[model samples]
Target chain A: MISFDLRIDRRGFSFDVSGQFDEGVTAVFGPSGAGKTTLLNCLAGSMRPDSGSIEIDGENVYSSADGIWVRPEKRRIGTVYQDGALFPHLSVRRNIDFGWKLVPAEQRRLDPLEIVELLGLSDLLERMPSELSGGERQRVAIARALAISPRLFLLDEPLASLDVARKGSILNYLKRVHDEFKIPMVYVSHSVTEVVSIASHAMLIRDGSVLGFDRPSALLLTAALDGSSVERFENILHGVVGESTDQLTTIEIDRISISTRHQNKNPGEKVVVSLGANQIILAPSEPNQLSARNVLKGRVKEIWSSNGKVFAEVDVGPEIIVELTESALNELGISVRSDVFLIFKSSSVDVFDA
Target chain B: MSSDASIIVLSFQIALVATGVTLPVGMLIAWLLARKQFHGKFALDVFVSLPLALPPVVVGYALLWLVGTHSWFGSLGESVFGSTLAFTWIAAALAAAVVSLPLVVRSFTAALAGVDPRLEVAARGLGSGSFRTFFTITLPLAYRGVIAGALLGFVRALSEFGATIVVAGNIPGRTQTIPAAIFTRISAGDSDAAWRLTIVSILLGVMALATHNWLLKLSSTVSRDSSEVG
Candidate 1:
């Protein structure tokens, strides 16, 4: 666990934050230039706060009042930067073991071989950083961080620089690492999908201040309500593959079968379906002859209105959220506990392996 | 030793020593200039780059004032070396280093500036001390420029004339480098030796420049490959 109450005063901007991070991945989500990186830097001890204190598991790492600033090397924290920052001169093996060798022999908690296997970096051991692909380099970066058995891990959008395909694979690998290591982490990212996929806890930050911090599922709802730069609300539904055709795949969620674009999966295989909240269309009842392939009935569980826009969560076997204008809601006379048909194109559901 | 061999050998020795002295100092100044912020930083920048704009003879004159028999360093030089630093081989080497230092510092600064400081921060966050991070990350990444800078210094030191003449004087087989020896040959109407020394100096210049370019090409190819992978 890591806790900090810090303030940074600069000529252009000031940052103020107080929070505690627990076990598992805590995604710090916000738009660009949100002082997310500055917060991480202060925690890493690279940037000292103008005033206030930081403690890692109750050990005070920095306190301006006590003049007890610890050097970054002594902080026992690991950081994976957005750019992968592997040592250009060292081989993958040496880079991964760079920090591991520094710790006393008896105190080492993780094995180099184990990390190489976990991150799938066995073949890259002899390769130079310059010779590895972006994904491979990031894997090596994570492996190197894990080698140190750090007290806490800080990841500043490790997948931001990768392409979509690479991002998906890397996200899966990150989840595996987090699950295996169980170290508390502060993962900074601006992507909503990434936060939903990996983070158990979420911190909403904007303009150098902590907006809210809690479970991702709970905090994101409030974030959508606030409408303060947390753009593009997305809903992730867990389901299982049921039937598939060349053009269509049906996913069974509880008692409902929802169709999506063709997915390469077998029956009974677990999958996750992603649909943007803005993509869902709601009607008072099922409309005939619609081009949309999926339509299910559900009673509205909750509805929050702001700025003439209504965000409603509907329970149709698997819960779905739909964002609509207040005018449309008024016209349809929809309210909480009202039965409604949620419709969306099959192509809109992006299915990924769980 | 023959005049030709003596000129060639002593010139190389002086250049080697000058480059050796300039490298570490140049890298230190370059790292500071690239990474730090402090009062008088601009003044320091101007001071470090002054030699590039000033004439070599002016540097020689300043060296003469500092190391001549009239100052504290001069007295130390006298006691340590059994003579004033002026008109000595050591003074020739010192003069060459001063004239070439700006080139070393400039190349090093540019190289250091190109490196991402975030890499160093990441290293520190991974439990690496500042010194370790520098040697492991910063130095290796900037080595191409560092070598290029040293080659430039060596070439400049090898051809030094104005400053060496002012401080080291034209003592054959002692402080008479290639340029000084060329002057000596041409002054005595020995056109053949002058022409031969001229050819040697040209060849040396060409070789040093070629090496510098080759190193740059190698560094670029490696960087390009790394970026492609990235």
Candidate 2:
């Protein structure tokens, strides 16, 4: 495991983050110039932040205050850049086994032959780097880094340069490597697809600060992914697949049961339900159960404002947040501790990024 | 015919000796210029290239003062070899090397600059130090440039006229080179013999260019093949 408090100042931007990179894949996702790659460089000991501490397995690799900055070459952390950075003169075999044979015989963890086979480079071992495809070159780069048997791995947009198909294949390979290695990795990428596929934990960064860090499933339902960025109807909700009924359906988000008129996939398949939070209407005084497909009664737990709009936190057994206009809240006489019916048009929302 | 032919042969021998003597030092200096950045790097670079802009006679005179058995370097040369460098084949070689230093440096510098720094990082992480990476990765990658520079330096030394005449004194068979002998024959009105050596000069120039082009082609072809495989 690796833990670091990042405080990187470059040009006009400054990034500060405090998080734990546990063993497995932890992805840093954000827009461009968000200092994700800069963080990787810090972890690799190549780019020392303005001031912070970096520790791997509780061993401090760098701390500017204590004068404990470790040089990159001495840092025993493997870094794979976007270019792969394979040595051109060395054959694929030599490139992959480059540092493996140099380490004291006892410390070498993975066998060179095994890495070659794992990376599918056995047939191309004798060939030089100039002879490999982009995908093959990246594989060799990964194998070479693994050959060093380092305690930590830093992958900075390893598939960012490849085409879509190649990127997909390489990302899959990367996921497999992260799963098998058990070494802590700080995977830096801006692509949503790449992050969603392999990252168990996500750190949402913007403007050089850690906007949020949480498990992907939890963060998906928050206001961040609530389609605030998208005005259409976007909401991420976590719920389990309940027993199938009829054309009329039953759905459970956390503990509160909601009847969704939309049906996709079979029962027992857990999923993240995404829909327009704006579609939910608040009704406090309804004479009869109207034509609204989803009508769940829950108390208004919290009300928050953003950009002059309102989002009501509803405690439907558990808490579920809904975004709506201030006019609608006032028209329904909605306030904290007020019991209100939640109406949503089912089939307008569907499960995504399961 | 025999005298003219002998002058031509001796002139070529002197050029060959000069090229052979200057090559290794030129290569080392070129690598230093291309790969290192020390204090006064620009000053040192200018110093290495000075022989190119300076008059060939000035370079010859400077060498004469430095190694002509009277000055400090001349005295050191006398102490080391017990023979003065002036009016000697070695002096012509030294003069040609001085003049050709810039070419080798520029060519080799470009070659070294083309090597990707990422490759060096990969090698170092793989546990090889600076020297190993330079030799195994950097040097081989830029070999065409090195070869082209060497050939260019050799050609410059082979065609050296002003410096050779001043330092080596254009003696027949022992210190003479083709260009120096041709100059002497022209001065003495031996037109037919001068023309013959002129043909030899032309041939040498063509061969240097041919070799340079061949090396360039080979470099590109090899690079293409490697990239296709990689």
Per-residue error at B33 for model 1, in Å? 1.7
TM-score of model 1 relative to the true fold? 0.94
Runs in model 2 deviating more than 4 A are A1-22, A29-31, A42-74, A88-91, A123-133, A163-168, A200-354, B1-39, B68-72, B218-230
The parts of candidate 1 lying over 4 Å away from their true place are A264-273, A350-354
lDDT of each: 0.87, 0.73
Best by DockQ: 1
Q: What is the CAPRI rating of model 1's predicted complex?
A: medium
**What does candidate 2's lDDT look like per residue over A160-221, in tens digits?**
77875676567657766776777877788765545555667878676777777787545544
The TM-scores of all predictions, comma-separated, are 0.94, 0.73
lDDT per residue as tens, model 2, B130-222:
777778778888889778877887788778777667777777766777787788789999999889889988998999989987987887787
Q: Tell me the lDDT of model 1 at A273.
A: 70
Per-residue lDDT of A201-283 in model 1, one digit per residue for the tens?
A: 89988888888898886777777777866775678777899989999999998889999988767999987777888899999
